[model samples]
Target: MGFKFDWFMKGMLGAVLLAFLWPEPGAKGGFLQPELLNKLGVALVFFLNGLALSLASMKDGALRWRVHLLVQCSTFLLFPLLGVALLWGSAGWMAAPLQIGFFYLCALPSTVSSSVALTIAARGNVAAAVFNATLSSLIGVLLTPLWMAWVLHQSGGNFAVGPVIVDLLLWVVLPLVLGQFSRPLLKDWASRHKGLLQKVDRITILLLVYTSFADTVKEGVWSRYNPLLLLQTVAGCALLFLLVLALTQWGARLLGMPRGDRIASVFCGSKKTLASGVPMAHLIFGANPAIGLILLPIMIYHPLQLLAGGMLAQRWSSAEAAPS
Candidate 1:
């Protein structure tokens, strides 16, 4: 337990340090060019996603359908609505760019690798985790843009959903679909090379984070958002995380879900996917590179969520082992 906590904390600290230390010469060029390093990181992330998914053991009969339904509601319908409401309420006060960032974060999908890892650590239903993660990614491609359009429209921004959808289909959905289709040929190889792939996943995420933060720094986004606003964003994200975590857990219990399914629902439903969000942000809001600053909430919250969720899972697993 101590080892796991130590490792997680160290990895997070490393990521944060890397974000600050990574050079930002590209940002000075006045264009958000896709550096070869960043593109390679994105591709590696997708490849590992495909590999991790292939190793997942999903049993159709194992899950409680009602629990899955509850998860979907929390992830797809409930969270997006909350995000729209928050943005609408703050529209009069928030800067236009930050408003877009808030909306974009809300529309993003749930995390995949971390979700399953936490679920497995907690002794939850891994298969359900995979299913929910994959399904959320698929649905998010469409839902994110739609929800963003609605939010932006309400906020009086001129956002065209059609172009967003086209971009999503081209960049996010198609890569995922191709990865899924290639799973048969890659799964065995991935299994054999799990260690190497794991390293690749870690490196890719680190590069993505560095590039993203570099963009924010380059765009003068940090200066635009003061300390107070940064704190507010963090508070808002914490509230959002707590709300979803509680709601998902309560819904799971209310539906009489088993322990494993409940764990899966809570972890999978409560989190957002950075892997998907970073790429989608580049595709959808590339015109404004500063839009990546909006993802800060998720980026900040992701590690916190994982640390908290992991500890909770560890506790639950220990309790389950105690004899009656």
Candidate 2:
């Protein structure tokens, strides 16, 4: 989550930059274009994930049901509720797609790696962090699409829940299930090639970003958005993050969670996963001209959460180290 670039993130930025500058590669083309690659990449990414997951570790973490419930509720339920309220109030200021996009950001799952990493840095419950983070992603595989379908349907859009669910099961869920079932045969090999598989996850997300942005660019998405809307998106996301962080902290204390559990709750519950968000956007918003606008809040929220979480983790860690 630091400012330093991982080669994967760099590739992500490069893909977006390339798409922005010259979108012809990712632009609408025949069957062999970037769009088709995105579909295959999505399947491949989830399948590899199925191989790489440690079911035993996930099971071990599952025993902490209360903590897990809190984190997932905060991630899936509370965030979206708050986002709805904000989007409702901001409709005048924010455009239609962007307003809903902000709400979409709230419904994303917690980051798998960074949530645990930040929890460890803050002296939080790392095992619970891992458990909740993993569980959040798995849940999001279904929940995110359902949430999007509901939200869009409520807004009277053409997004059909049946189709959305079918697509998710086919592209995301099926591959994951296949990978899980195939784990016995491939687990050892997956562990050996873990680093390489993670790169696949990064690449899948990048390709989705490239193609989505390229489509939006062709539709003149950037032309509609201005400097003020961009700034507003940042401010709104920061405020939303603060609100979630504060509420989770209060909720933890009310539930009599320990300091470690409280720390995990705050970090895991308050943060959203960009890695998952970008790809899911493609699945949900498929070929929408305003896809770029829908991603604005999410793109802004990613870095904001990192910087905010980094500072908060350092301060909390320092406080924990001090004698009371």
Candidate 3:
């Protein structure tokens, strides 16, 4: 709960460095055949998620309609609009694909693990955090693509939602549904090996990040930019996170949410899932040369959200524990 640096975020940075150094193995047509591995790993990630999901936990959180509405709207609706406004306001500041990356960042769902963890750390409504985070991921499988397709079309790029949705159903939803169906038989094992399953999730995501950045490097996407560009991206991502964080808290207060629900809303509503975003980017963008550039905002935002949310959680926890 204290502001400790997360090793997984460290691993994410290490993955990018590896990709920047030796991109061949993870790049397309490389020895690893990353395209095939990507597809499999992505499906496996979601399948394991379905297996781990507890219906009882979700149900306990499901009845809080007001909390759920606020969280979901903040995640899906508020963030994307912010992306649009940023894109409009910045006009010629960056290239089109990079701008699209910012939009893609906004369009992603709330993260599952960190949001729930931070909520628990802050003595928030963990049940609602779990429900809203999981629901956002599922909804994002559909909405993210639709949002992307519309944006790409507006920019004169072709992104066919129909084909992408069908592919997602096969690789994402089908595996998830199958895992859920098999849960009755395997839930006990999953619970017992929770740490192992979580490692699997992180490994898959790391692999995706490596391959994605590797592809970008192989295509010389980074050559067009400099260190200042990354700094600019970090600043932009930080600003976006702060705005969403403030707005979610404001909305929760306006609704007169309890302390726990407010904590859950602020944490869950403000997160963007690196887990879902990376895999979905690979699926949606499909080997576009600028893939790494497209993911830059999200990769940056992931750690920023964690650090900020973790600090806030610790402060809130201490405040709650203090004698009144």
Top-scoring candidate (TM-score): 3
Clashes of each: 2, 0, 0
RMSD of each: 3.3, 2.0, 1.2
Per-residue lDDT of model 2, residues 182-299, tens digit only: 9999888888988877877787787778887788787787787666887888889889999998999998888888888888888899889887787677778876878877887888
Clashing pairs in 3: none
TM-score of candidate 1 to 2 decimals: 0.84
Assess candidate 1 and give its lDDT: 0.70
What ranking of all candidate models by lDDT puts the best one first? 3, 2, 1
TM-score, prediction 2 = 0.93
lDDT of 1 by residue, 101-176 (tens): 6657667778877788888888888788888877777678788877777776776767778877775665555566
How well is each residue in 2-40 modelled by candidate 3, as lDDT tens digits? 555567787888999999999999999988898898899
Best-to-worst order by TM-score is 3, 2, 1
Top-lDDT candidate index = 3
Off-target runs (Cα >4 Å) in candidate 2 are 1-5, 30-32
Off by over 4 Å in 3: none
Candidates in order have lDDT scores of 0.70, 0.81, 0.90
